[model samples]
Target: MTATSVARGATTEAAARIMARADELGAISSRADALERTHLTPEHRVAADLVGAWMREAGLTVHEDAAGNVCGRIEGLRPGLPAVLLGSHIDTVPDAGRYDGPLGVLLAIEVARGVRAGALPFALEVVAFSDEEGTRFASALSGSRALAGSWVEDWWSFADADGVTLADAFTAYGLDPGRVADAARRPGSVLAYLEAHIEQGPHLEDADLPLAVVSSIAGARRFALTVTGHAGHAGGTPYERRRDALVGAAELVLEVERVGRSSGVVATVGQLQAFPGGVNVVPGRVELSLDLRAEDDASRDAAWDRIRTAAERIAAARSLRFDAAETYRADAVACAPWLQDAVRTGAQGAGVADPPVLWSRAGHDAMVVAGLAPVGMLFVRNGNGGVSHSPDEIVTEADVAVALDAFAATVAQLARRLEPGDTSTAATDEDRAPEAGA
Candidate 1:
């Protein structure tokens, strides 16, 4: 049989396996709601272990790293071909939907299974990354960044809302946080990487498309602002003589929303706290957490600057003290053009409707890997306007099947075209620095 015929057959088999696996996993009651109380607890680790076992069952060599990332590798027929990396995080936000991260990891395993059955020509590695949500730490994308070498060791000391440091949490879970360096990947082993995920937005559902090719992952900056003002009895202080901290905070929140809307960016004030909490007393101080994101770094920076300036001006005019501090920032990542084309072609081959290219407002582990290899992503339609990070998040089995088919087709194409000598060695350098938030 010709190479094209072999590839076509492999694609069919892979798609079938993916569909079956999606059904099996999705039906297992892995809803994020069930795991929320534990919050990155052993429950997630069990899920990762299951994924690793599935990869082994699919005929790959699987292992879990010190940082708890599960990786499965399939050897290539040609010794020199670069390995293709695929998969996503297994961790989810509190009350997250089941399909968000686990689907990508499982689909990658199905691709490997197809290669094994059909004698594909390239090496493949499927990974189920840990800690993408950062629910237990201030840092998000922990596992991916460690693999990319962008994570700082000092961050291990950072704590969660419960005041539990990453180190303490890892120890509680039977993992040694000191061995985090073991998670870092050698530079240049991966030639390309691809991830399949739920749209996490309403675009695909609204457009009635089964899939989407990600154009880029938006850059993000998080900040904490504090406003301090004089406190007085609510009944005793005249409205005109008072310097209410809540008033300044409220205005700043509105300003952030207004600026984001007018600039075509996205900004949200998700958390706010008040000091001296009592209805009878005027608010003496306020603290707010602001999240800003944009499709490009420049725009994200500009939006942050605008927000800071607005906050400072408002505080000064209201006779209050204002301070703002950055908590985290992730740069925008553009998908590789060739890989994107491959994704589109794969969807076409799968008999799915033409997939649209769209920007992702949310971040993913794939963004970190893009700096190490050619990277692209596929997104399945999510119901209810792509609502995610909630128990109500939903996606149809058919949409998942379609995404799986596309993922397999694309992996098959890459395997056939990869050359042994082309394997990237850039990741192997001992001194090579990992990019931030990789």
Candidate 2:
């Protein structure tokens, strides 16, 4: 059936089922007071089982990959074909909301169940990637990276907070450490991948749109910066005589905010600590964490240059030694034009013409999967100012219903294109920004 003729994707049944599934998954967490599930843990395994059952019911052949990724697939006309993949992660950070990663996985299953009747040209694969939150090993996207053949040996040696090694965790989880490579999906076997997740921001809610296409995932860089000076008695040291490291750090923090505001980038100093911090002493040293993100790679890097320069100048003038080191860097990823068009077409087919598009500031399994194939994403509006990664995160079922319908339409639209080997014309990134709701 054509996308235009397809009914609302799996309806409220799908939405309700997703909510129920999320609750079950949420219950299998590490903490009684909050949701805290980590990779390669019992909670993760149970979640895999729970999602696997839904995949099976959707008429897809399901299994847990060697890397512990819960995967389900519906075959194409033949036994093998380049598959269209859909999904998000099942793992969560400490006290995470149910909607962030879980919602995407559930919505993908809903799409799969709704589209199985059409039996399109390409096979469909739904994956509940085992790890996207790096709570267990301090390495995010572990599951998707394995699937992308981007697994690094360094991660094996990675340890958790309690000094549990990843290799040890694998063995404890009854998974073979030697077989994680088996999860790597070959490059040519995937046509595209799509993920439906919470917007994780207030843009969609502010604009009163329930669904939006994701144009790109922002690139991010993290740093640990230290400013060192001399400590002195607060009562003895005059303001001009005191070389305070904390004061320098405070100035740099303000600079970061100003740059972020004027540059339209997101830069945060989430952590700040002062050595020799006392009510009666000038601080000797200050350490801070810098998290910077931008919609594009050039802008992100360029902004970093500006920030670093400003920090150096500020520290030099304050006579405080400044040292900064990058702890992590991930490049931005743009959604494939063909996939973006499919999402647009899907939204239109679902009765939303020119639906708003959004750029995700947060990372997801989609970023890692982009290494495997072309990627697209649909964002569901979030509640409570779109605050995610916490228990306060929430979603309205009506928005979810709308998101599922659009996601299903996206599946159908892509299926139609796959049948004919058609690639839609590429559009400018201006289409990626959120516009006033129509």
User: lDDT: which candidate is best?
Assistant: 2
**In order, what is each prediction's RMSD in angstroms?**
4.0, 4.3
Best by TM-score: 2
Candidate 1 ranges beyond 4 A from true positions: 1-33, 37-40, 117-121, 159-165, 168-178, 416-434
**lDDT tens digits, residues 1-438, model 2?**
356433455577778887888888888898999999899888888888889999999878999998999999888756687788999998999988988899999988887786543367778899999889988898788888889888877888999888999999999998999999998988578778899999889998898877788889988899999999999999999999889999999999999999999998999999999988788889999999999988988988888899999989997899889999999888888887778888888777666777887889998887877776778998888989999999888888777777888888888776666654455422234322221000
**Model 2, residue pairs in steric clash:** none
- The lDDT of model 1 is 0.75
Give one digit per residue, the lDDT tens place, for model 1 in 365-395. 8788765666788988889878987656776
Clashes of each: 10, 0
Cα displacement (Å) at residue 197, model 2: 0.5
RMSD of 1: 4.0
List the pairs of residues colliding in candidate 1: 80-420, 81-420, 186-427, 187-426, 187-427, 187-428, 188-424, 188-426, 188-427, 368-438
